[model samples]
Target: MRTIAKLENVSKTYKLADDQQLEVLSQINLDVQEGEFIALLGQSGCGKSTILRIMSGLIKPTSGTAYQYDEKLQGINETISIVFQSFALYPWLTVYENVRIGLIKRQLSSSQEEQEITEAIRLIGLGGHENAYPKELSGGMRQRVGFARALVAKPEILAMDEPFSALDVLTAQNLRAEVIDLWKNKEGTFKSAFMVTHNISEAVSMASKIMILSSHPGRIVHVIENKMPYPRNEKSPAFLALVDEIHGLITTLNLPDTPKEHPISKAIFENAESKAFENIPYVQISRILGFLEVLKDDNGRTKIFELAAKMKEEFGSVISIAKAVEILNFIETPGQDVVLTELGRKFIEAESTNQKLIFRKQLVLMKLFRLIIDKLTTLKTLAEDDLKVEINNRFPYENADKMVDTIVDWGRYGEIFEFNADLKVFTQFEDSV
Candidate 1:
């Protein structure tokens, strides 16, 4: 198979305020080849979408090269078309017009354009709704229009960035099946497909090759060649094994304090220390507590995937909650299983006051929170804006305001500090004062 799109030793970094750089992708290399469906899977904010953008030539890598058909790619790759997660439809345009936009750059005559558009609409099961506006369509139908628009151009590579994520589960399942059917049947329209998704099952079901990425300067850590036949049986042992394997890999990648035997924790912590401050996963306090409570109910041990299913939450969200609690030393992820620590059990079982004390002790142990508390200790009070500035100085890659809010939430919950929303200030908690 011919290599269609390739990123060779690619790295992407964004310059933030005060000359700080946030590296998103590090030394990444991948290829889109003919006769292959590729899936990029990772935690949220792991630069999966950025890889899609780079491959589509929507954005240039800060360093390294992106190649298309063995040539250095510049500007947009005419052979690639993308279906965005948000549907990205023009609300004012009818479905037909939206699909027509795909062929606008091509020098097709009016008749040719109409034929292609009509064929794409029909091919994507949007035949009767061509005249309807976006508002008239359901979430699944809107995504179908997105697919129609992407397919109308007859591009060689169809790139979808979480295209089905916004739809209901049933609708997403149906759409995924339809897309796979299209790939199998629609020969020569698109030679390859690349998708960025967080859904392990989705990737397992559809992708011929799955690349797993690590968070915080995302790197391709694992690539699985899925030999399972098309129309995969999710309930089958082979399929379940692949899912479990990927789950284990992703859980290890996301959780820093995995089993000591694993070398991943060393690299993860080194990366954290080099940055001076670890980027806290912006998870709510209640979610962290609730997650621990669930773990307690599970007799303090369960796989992360099982916990996610039990909580009826997405895997990424569950991972974030787990990371937050893990950072506080409330949980230890041994392989795929999250085992509650002694502190975690005690905190969950203790009265509210004891729980707060335990949480406070954990919060102060973290470098980021310790920095804030030390400043608050010396100053007794700090403005929210100043706190945000300090956080931004330490974590240039994060959203400063959002980080401040998370800090406030966690600190207030632990009784380590108090934020007066009305005054827009963070004051030392009364107990500490």
Candidate 2:
């Protein structure tokens, strides 16, 4: 029970071009103990991966320090290895060469390198594919090569940033089981592993400790230990209970109306007082409408967590979609549950043309869309560059393009206006108001 990696009062901030600091992680004080599997679970953009990079000495925190085995980490060293979501393999190299590369600068004898590579591949269940190129292997096999490459180094700690995320469900499940088995029996070279994942069941099943991170300037809000024994049965009441409990915990946790003091991110986005260009990411309009239909089929009321589980989507993705629904005033999210508003029900019941009409009304009501409409009326043809510049003036420079693009998509899709992509201009269509 020795402390291996520690983050003491770590706060990381990225300076943006707008002279604004994007706070990544704040006051993160945590540690990894010997023989512990720690899962950092949170929404995307929560800076979970940033924590991994900081611990691995891949990046330095703006404030606080990262320690490896009681020593302040100077830089990336051989003591730790990371398996990334992407295979991170040289496509031209064979599996043997890829695994062998990790031991390149170690000054090991040729015999030593061969032995380590062979054993690492074998342990990761990639025994016979050593000579095959990465292009010849399946995604799962390539990831096993990634595992083998990280393992051949004999690191004290293993860090993975959504390593299994890109694989199929069954494949990810099998890999998780294998890794958990290795940890259960102390087969792998590492004393502990840190995994950044959003999979609730995966975190509950594998991690001896789970850290729940909050979005918008991420922070570790809770750290819980798993008391259940190994070989956790997903069908069992205990496993289900843990899943439900965590889901409830997350959905109930203070998901503030205002995300981190930003009025623009608030559920009630700026009113007439301010016209801050909103940065809400656009999920496909079809997906948004379909999501509402699913909710409607569920009687127009379902908890966000329940909807996420049913849709097999991440909480963050669903929440962002719900935010869009909120922006259009199509759904009433009084709390964790969403209720389809009368406008939403009407839109669903309407015919195609009527639906487009409703969508047009909703789009025109948006602050950005209204501003665009105003510009089009004044200029006759609003250049996309001018629209982006207007957005940048109101919001962060980073989100300007995304914000403007989303606005343009809604404009064209809703039939509120026409967009000439080649000319990068917004023009009034025959149906435009």
Candidate 3:
């Protein structure tokens, strides 16, 4: 890999009021290849965006160094552009002028800069609308202008801090596809893209490499390779499997001390403070997924306290046991010994046999919805055997039956993702069918 950027044992510390140095990032090291789409993923305050700033030379590491433009550590280079979460476009300037500003500052000819600005506007699908000011455009359109302005600079690498975080899902998905297309078409000249994102699926689907940073003192914990090809089939077994694997890796890192009342990690088994699934931080998600992993055995049945001891042994905390029970809905009474209930057994079996498959299938279904379709069809004729085969083909599991049961339940809960099931298996709305 051609080293486009690198952070060498980097550390950043800040002096507080009492002159106490607080470390934000420690022993951080990451190297990105030329034209590699890399995502830095972690919880808030994990220094994900900080690393981007460091790489962009917006901030200096207190210790160690970063290298860009193929040399020793240096200050920020001119060949970089950043698109902030907030579209940092100029309020006074029209979209054209806003984009033309960078070229003008570079001392390009008036005609040349205007031509470049025109090209950029067209590329971002905002051609004639260049006369519109920021305030005149909708949020999505304003973002499009920002993207055009960034591209007009013609930098080697682009740094985006949650660029689409504010957009609605439909618009964000379209913009994401457009950005990916932009990168692909301009690969060598553009070099690569580096970004910070809270969305795991966005990271997984887009980046060639995803680096996960740990919290407290932020630092790189794991780096994942997205081996699946571009225009990735999010619904395919391969893509989902990779997503689950990454989820597992993240879960292991944030698995906390075991609980006193339960057999699961507090991070995994949530009562009220669990952040309502989607709002759950990445750190918490990782631990929750890991705890779920321990609830199952080779067969899809619950393993009682055997898995409990194994989990505790690995995590070195009693909270693991408590969380395990909570997640399994396994009751632990003072008079009752540790045993798996019917619900607990089913949960374990479902998790053990079907969690990854379900996750992958759902993601794929989402992808299918994004692609244009002519006619919708119904899956009512998908017999039990056909459903079984579809599950096996798209999301294989050790326990196909258990996986099916879970998938049906997910469908019932509106979590099964009805609108976009799979390109291979599309079903029309009930009335249309």
Alpha-carbon shift of residue 287 in model 1 (angstroms):
1.7
| Candidate 3 lDDT over residue span 1-433, tens digit each | 5777788999987764223345678889887777789988875566788888888888999998888756866777556677888988899889888877657446777788877888888888887787888999878888888787778788888778989988888999899988888998893146789889866678888999898887546878788888678887778998877766765554455442332222222444456423222111212324534454554342333332334355643211223343333433433322112334454444445743464444434323332221211123332333334554533333221133444444343333323333334432434334321
The candidate that wins on TM-score is 1
TM-score of 1: 0.89
Q: Write the residue-wise lDDT of candidate 2 on 213-319 in tens digits.
A: 97666889888888888888888898888888777666555333444445444444455435444455656687687788888888888888888877788887787
- Ranked candidates, highest TM-score first: 1, 2, 3
Lowest-scoring 10 consecutive residues by lDDT in candidate 3? 274-283
Tens-place lDDT digits, model 1, residues 1-433? 8999999999999876445567789899999998899999987889999999998889999999999989999899988999999999999999999999998788799999988988999888898998999999999999999999999888889999999889999999999999998898863288889999999999999999999998667899999999999899999999999999998888777774533222433544455553556678888899998899899999999989999999988798899899888888888887788999998999999999988888888888888888778888999888877767766555555666557778888898888888889999877887862
Greater lDDT among 2 and 3 belongs to: 2
TM-scores of all predicted structures: 0.89, 0.85, 0.60
Roughly what TM-score does model 2 have, to 2 decimal places? 0.85
Alpha-carbon lDDT of model 1: 0.87
Local accuracy by lDDT, each model: 0.87, 0.82, 0.62
